[model samples]
Target: MIHSCPLLRSLTLLLLMAGLTFSCQTRNSSDNTTEQTAALPPAPNFNADSAYAFVARQVAFGPRVPNSAAHVQTGNYLVETLKKYGFTVTEQPFTATTYDGKKLNARNIIGSYNPQASKRIMLASHWDSRPFADADSTQKNSPVPGANDGASGVGVLLEIARVLSQDSTKLSLGVDLVFFDAEDWGNSAVATDAYAGFCLGSQYWAANRHIPNYTAYFGVLLDMVGAKGATFPKEGYSTKNANEVVRNVWTTASQLGYSTYFIDQQGPSITDDHVPVNEIAKFPMIDIIHMQVNNLSQTFFKEWHTTEDDMDTIDPATLKAVGQTLIQVLYNEAQPVI
Candidate 1:
């Protein structure tokens, strides 16, 4: 995904230059309500080593680019892994014609926990690595390893599934972990308003949902979540569309003593997979992505969309922060809102 607005990025820089805090202006008003949401039962431990291993496994498959053997192998591995955790898995296969006119075979993989429950929440991450590392100085056409951009988020969710499997009690709401495919095949030159080819799997799934009239209370999409020294401010689109969910998540992260990573800052708008999930599916969703106003070259992490986004870029500590926060969020939502 790309940072959607240069103006917003500039504004963030100006604010930082002016010595202003990057917090949400309206956060105080809803703090009480969000605080209530974060005060639920404690979540199970999120193992960083296990999550790291999962990330390594995905990277081991090489780049999971569309229509490639590695892509098919990784897809099968994801399905089998989800099934091992007792999730009801479904594969929604489709053909997506990208902006450059490449017809790619893609599938959005879904894993449902507590499928019978009416109340539900969605967690998602793009599973396919970018076909080209355009951001790299050399090897501009080579495939991205996607250790942080793709695999990290999936690894976190997979660990969540494993942790949930070990828990004894039933959750309060159903959970859907969606591994979106064909998300990184678009032309990076015109990524923002004209990013039609990006996030193909989500766009398709939103229009032609696997379940008839399927809906969720809220959703969260994770991207670029395992980079070293990564910071996840509240993304702009999420604040616009799913402020309640953002407030709760940020509050929970702070409560868990991770305020450093999950800051109170408001990040730039990102054109990512969650946009379709919000606009097309008509479900409020938020994006937890790594964006830095401090980065001179790009708003994303240093290795974004580059061949350098390999296993060396993956940070176990960063993974633990995001994974643990997500686990806390889910367990918190497992309790009925008071």
Candidate 2:
């Protein structure tokens, strides 16, 4: 939701500039580190129409700002949908203090499949819209519709949950779908700290997990994935903290012929929900976010954080590209020997 040079990178730069002597130590590592490939089954078809409907349903609820009636209704809809799809649902409700000293009634919705399975994969997205369109010239104080910024990622995951519920035997490992709230409420443009109010729901979840001692093999967070001609580059923090996960997802996308959207380029580190997950929860997570690498002023999509982020900006083809790639990744994963 907010973009910044990660503090880790800054500290590393400082260390390098100081010319600190570091010892080079090497150890014998296994050459056969790759997991064994199994005969893959056909993945469930990702229906773009179904995903689009999910996005539309959330948009119809208006801007899902925390503490608003629309926010509560949309949270209920997500929990109900996950239950209908046969997931063991969990809701973590909490009160979060915003950067401006306002209390937000935030809730993190989780849908667990094969809860008994020890090995699991986590997928997450923010479902709360920005309370103000701070980037827009007009209606700067008005709430953003967040059709692509908030609803798009959640929509893709909901469709995935539906497919996984109908056919549980395809993937042996468990899948957890998390819808984090209050991610877009930060005002980074005016603050010295980039990660202030952003990712409040994820920050809460990382500290107090829904399930006791919950851990996943790895996590993937989706954001702004339904815009037309969206390009997702390897974000800096993801590359720095979870390089293997970034490589895995990007390589999978390339193999699936979706290389155009998942570009092999370096992107600026964003202060998003994934940061808190990787830092606090100690999970390896990567963000599949649309960013403009060429333009510093408009790093994200043009409509990002703007009132113009409505249903008209969402593209079904973009949704299909991301959703299908995820389906491939999740289904292909073998149960790790944990």
Candidate 3:
């Protein structure tokens, strides 16, 4: 999932479903003629239970605010988990000043697999809990539980990491999982400009990537993807910036029998993490974010920026739809060597 957003997080728009093209070639030998078609690689099964547990574990740590103890603990946990899953992990720590001039100690955690492969794919999600619940009428100063907005995306990616590690399938390309920090400290609700201070982690990463001169074939981002009856439309920016990536991913989801969830509609542009990746890093990325169809502007989840965004808002089915779709996308691109 890759797209751009405001309080909207990392995200995409869509190209037409028919844009994804495949071809088979024929070779005429002296003895016989043969046709070779595209191979269907087996995508590892995405475990909803495991993904759910990962979400729950993050919630138990309380809000992962940039300067909070929970933030530090969760960072350590993420690093250890990726390492356990055989990824070479890297932590990029940097300081950033927020919209209100508050200094944030932020770190972008990155996990790399098959570093030697030049062809690569990137997956990303923000990992910080919002410091304020501005969306709720009450508890305006309370921190959001972030079950969907932050933790849900990370949980799905973590499950993917586990699957990639456990499965014997040898991927034809490299994969990078990036958990961005300080993404939720923006002043969307309190400010006149919606995108004044959002996506700090992505902004930093886009400018200073973990690997110098690093590039990928494409990228996908996930945000607020584990809610009940979650709807994923083609984000406005994604449709325009990386329509091909959107077409391939959305088409894959539909092929996997998830057309109900991944709706083939246009969504509003968001100022999320994927914005910088596309605009600054020059990467073609798509955002697989959950959005409401009725609301054109700020179509985030109802519990977004609210304290009510807790474990109760998370649905295992939604997680399965998103996680499984991502796995399929990866495996579909894989071409094993003889």
Q: Which regions in candidate 1 have their CA more than 4 angstroms from the true location?
A: 1-40, 190-193
- Evaluated at residue 25, the lDDT of candidate 1 is 39
Candidate 1 residue pairs in backbone clash: none
lDDT of 1 by residue, 246-296 (tens): 998998888777888999999888889999989999999999999886666
State TM-scores per candidate.
0.87, 0.86, 0.86
Tens-place lDDT digits, model 2, residues 46-136: 9999999999999999999999999999999999999999899999999988888899999999999888887899999999999999889
lDDT of 1: 0.89
Query: Residue 167 deviation, candidate 1, in Å?
Result: 0.4
CA lDDT of every candidate: 0.89, 0.89, 0.88
- Model 2 lDDT on a 0 to 1 scale: 0.89
Candidate 3: where are CA atoms >4 Å away? 1-39, 189-194, 295-298, 336-338
Score residue 262 of candidate 3 by CA lDDT.
Answer: 94
**Least accurate 10 contiguous residues by lDDT in model 3:** 30-39
- Give the residue spans of candidate 2 off by over 4 A: 1-41, 192-194, 335-338
What RMSD, rounded to one decimal, does every model reach?
A: 11.2, 13.4, 13.1
lDDT of 3 at 214: 90
Model 3 clashes, total count: 24
